[model samples]
Target: MKYNLIFGGIRNQDGYEENTEEVLRSFLSEEMEIPNVGDIQFQNVHRLGERSDGKERSIIARFTRFSDHERVIRAAASKLKNKPQFSIYQQYPREINERRKKLIPRMKEFKRQRRHAKLVYDKLLVYGEVYNPDAHREPPPTIPGQPLPNNDGDY
Candidate 1:
């Protein structure tokens, strides 16, 4: 089934990075190829118009379909071990175009910088560490399955 995934958040200093993008692209490529799957194209990624007080950037990712979206979000949530605030919504091609219209200026700047850096340095600093698909093996299922208390004292 076709699925759309939308996620946005304030990025850390190093987020929206080339390496991060590569990792995500590779993961998505692999994940979307399983049996009973549809295309998993990356639709859009953008930096929010406004910046935070800490000078951090906000980024958004829009996937082509819902199942694809879910798979990516599940992978992310697993990696972070938290419920993701990322969202999903079905959109017509027109709606997607409208969204990208609003996001273009910010995205254009990044693209421009990338081009400039390539001309100047011959290469840009990008995420380089390779990822092993099975690197983070799931812990064994506990027989009693005792859940731990929240150590953050939020309770």
Candidate 2:
């Protein structure tokens, strides 16, 4: 899959407001020997505040191509004068595809459980015979203080 090692400089010049497009153009416009780096773009921009020179602004560039970690890094390195604090990464398309492949069975299992739980809940909500048991009238209660007959209600 195509991946980009995106990075660029923060120009510390007076009123230079780090134009990301310019830096990226400088990188992509070059004739690169590496086969990877098909196109380049600025992914993000930042203001790193004033440096010793004056206003400091950062430019983040993305080099798009299909290559491994080492190749992309090497390609980016060739374009820069100083060492870059970069993060190695893969393309989103590749990562998403891999995750989808892994999630198929788990998603099926989750759907199955949801259906089963819904069935049980529906049955409970229906108020079946077991939920409403047969109702009968209660017998009259005997008074405790009443006098008892010979073979009758003695306490």
Q: Name the best candidate (by TM-score).
A: 1
Per-candidate Cα lDDT values, in order, are 0.45, 0.41
Cα displacement (Å) at residue 35, model 1: 14
Cα lDDT of model 2 by residue, 89-112, tens digit: 333465575655454454455456
Q: Which sections of candidate 2 miss by over 4 Å?
A: 1-18, 31-38, 53-57, 62-72, 78-155
Candidate 2 structure lDDT: 0.41
Q: Name the lDDT value of residue 38 in candidate 1.
A: 35
Please report how far candidate 1 places residue 148 from its true position, in Å.
Answer: 47
Q: Which stretches of candidate 1 lie over 4 Å from their true place?
A: 1-39, 82-155
lDDT at residue 133 of model 1 (Cα atoms): 23
Q: Tell me the TM-score of model 2.
A: 0.27
